[model samples]
Target: MVESESTTKVNVLMVGTGEYTTGYVGGGAADSDKGAGVVALTMFDLRRRNKVSRVGMCGVNGKKFAGIRSHMQKNIGDVYNDMDLTCETFPEDTVVDPLAYEVAAKAFYPGDVAIIFTPDDTHFAIAMNCIQRGMHVMVTKPIVQTLADHQKLAALAHENNVLVGVEVHKRLDPFYADARDRARSNLGDFQYMYAYMSQPKHQLETFKAWAGKSSDISYYLNSHHVDWSEWTLAGMARPVRVTATGSSGVAQSRSMNTEDSITLTVQWENLNDQKTLGCAVYTSSWAAPKSDVHSQQRFFYMGSSGEINVDQAHRGCTVATDAAGFASVNPLFMKYTPTNGMFSGQGSYGVRSFENFIDACCAVNAGTAQPRDFDDGSLATVHTTMQGTAILEAGRMSLDMDGRPMDIQYDGNDHEPIAIVPHVFTG
Candidate 1:
């Protein structure tokens, strides 16, 4: 008799302890959308369902674990029945160690998994540590700041034979999934795409530490839409040049030397027909005023045959309260409300993203699947997501180089980016 892959329970270690991992930042629950968080809560519930085991969480400051545990106890455990939120903390409760993630990674076995939700600049180092240890990794968006680092991680993951996935949950959204499918099927050759995503200005304070110094709004927010656009036009079209512009008054006023908003215009050349080209504009900002929704996200796609529009933020759902006032909610991304007193958000695309990675890790561990099997554009693996990184790095370079256009050079075979250089005018 053979052991079933379904019966293989993989252990998980969550890296970083900010809002996305624990919903506890600066000693209390975050003021943003992920109050109960998406990562730890899902891990806790997955443990309850026996899908995973021995879940642990790691962060830079070990003292914050007390507050994080209390926050989870109140928001997640108290709300859902049979929810067990038990996990080991790294660097001991009394010690503060910046490199605690390495210690946590060492504790996990080779076949275990690690999900990284740290700041944008720290992703490559932490992910590299885990991958070298033979642990599968699922990193949050903007996987790395530079195309060079992105390529290095991809190469290392292949060398180590570990599954690596980028946590682009938007790819799992039902509406976005349908849109991608329709664009690939019904829509003709890609022509143009415009995408906008923004968060309220208050978020700047939440990320004040590294908002401008370590990263910018483009890498933090624009990565979402850029990846979607890349995923939509994969194999059919590839980005050739990128030009960017930014707005800077708001963040500078707050003493942060960063842009408040950024826009990137990318030129895409059709793979089959070099004569045909498409244009894409992606803009992101953290300076939006308070609105009914926390994040305002929408996109428009125009192809040779037809067009499609999506306003993902406002899905026609509104709620009014004297305490919080009238607001539009998106339960499709994450349904935090409990059903019958047990965790019922298993169907959420946000939840599905984590589950998909875990299942892939388990399958690989059971010898039923290989890491390369997920590179077929289904999961946002490192190999499939390099284009997004190229565009993002190019956008950053353009912003720094006085809005100069950057050129993306590809390998000509797989269409993956090989180098990014300034678009020098020869004529």
Candidate 2:
């Protein structure tokens, strides 16, 4: 017999306290788009709905909890009725521990859930720890910086019998989801795709601690479209090569040794027809001037039978205020506004992303579903997203090697990536 949702509610552990997790950066509430955050807010609401129980958050610096709680209280708790801001924080307030997440993970039992939103470099270790403990995990995009780590996580998740999802929220966007379906059903063979996403220059300040030191802009931004393209062309085509180029000066001027803009050009081969090929260009930057929206995201897709164009940043919705001036808003991604003294953004794609993961975890815990059950491409499981990781790592390698093209080699029959090698020249 299957257990009821109320009885099998999964406990959640959030593994980061940065901008995306809490919207509490540096000191107070983020001034950018995510004033209240996506993860914690969604988790709080999930708790309210009885989908989850006992929420906990872990971060390297324990001292930030006081400010984080205050920020959440003001932005989330105080604004929404019955919204609980209660969470167990890792590390004592006076102590700082880089490995505090390990301690936090021990507090939960097997089949619990963890959502990671940390730096690119820390994803592997943190996720590995969680999965090893038999906990389900949902990692932020660009899951890891290397293909080897990605494959390792996939193997370990299977070994531990846990579900591991990559939090590519764009896949849940209504427009993007519809486009993917149309491209798969109506559009013919893949041909070309162009994606551009950028954040304002101020983001460099928020990310200065690890801008180029830990990861680059392509891994930060391009991962979104790369994963989308991979999902869109799954089984239809596979990425063959990646060559990257980057421009600097803005970040350098800001005393950061990182590129201001980066572009990755990838070549894809149709699975059914090897002779036919497709190309995709993904560009990302953090040097964009301040605009009506926090990020400028748009993509163009072409196939043999049809084409698609999407401008996600501008959804034909704009708002003007005395203090904030003019701005374009996307309530579809996250509607932070309250309705009837309650949180009403449950229909948002961002909220759905977390809710979906929680539901999967609960199902697994209830013995109604297995971890591998989610690998059917419905969710961003570790198995289905290997190609995206390969492309992202290859792009980073190309940029580090002065723009040399890298070939993505896959194993026979399995279609899993085996190696990423430099392109060989022949006369």
Against the reference, the lDDT scores of all candidates come to 0.91, 0.92
User: In candidate 1, how many Å is residue 246 off?
Assistant: 0.2
Worst lDDT run of 10 residues, candidate 1, spans 1-10
Candidate 1: C-alpha lDDT: 0.91
Give residue 265's error in model 1 in angstroms: 0.5
Candidate 1 — which residues are off by over 4 angstroms? Answer: 1-7
C-alpha RMSD for every candidate: 2.1, 1.9
Clashing pairs in 1: none
For model 1, residues 61-103, the per-residue Cα lDDT tens digits are: 8888888889999999899999988899897889899899999
TM-score of each: 0.97, 0.98
Query: After TM-score superposition, what is the CA distance of residue 295 in candidate 2 from its true location, in Å?
Result: 0.2
Question: Given candidate 1, what's the lDDT at residue 221?
Answer: 88
Scored against the true structure, residue 397 in model 2 reaches a CA lDDT of 94
Backbone atom clashes (below 3 Å) for every candidate: 0, 0
RMSD of 2: 1.9
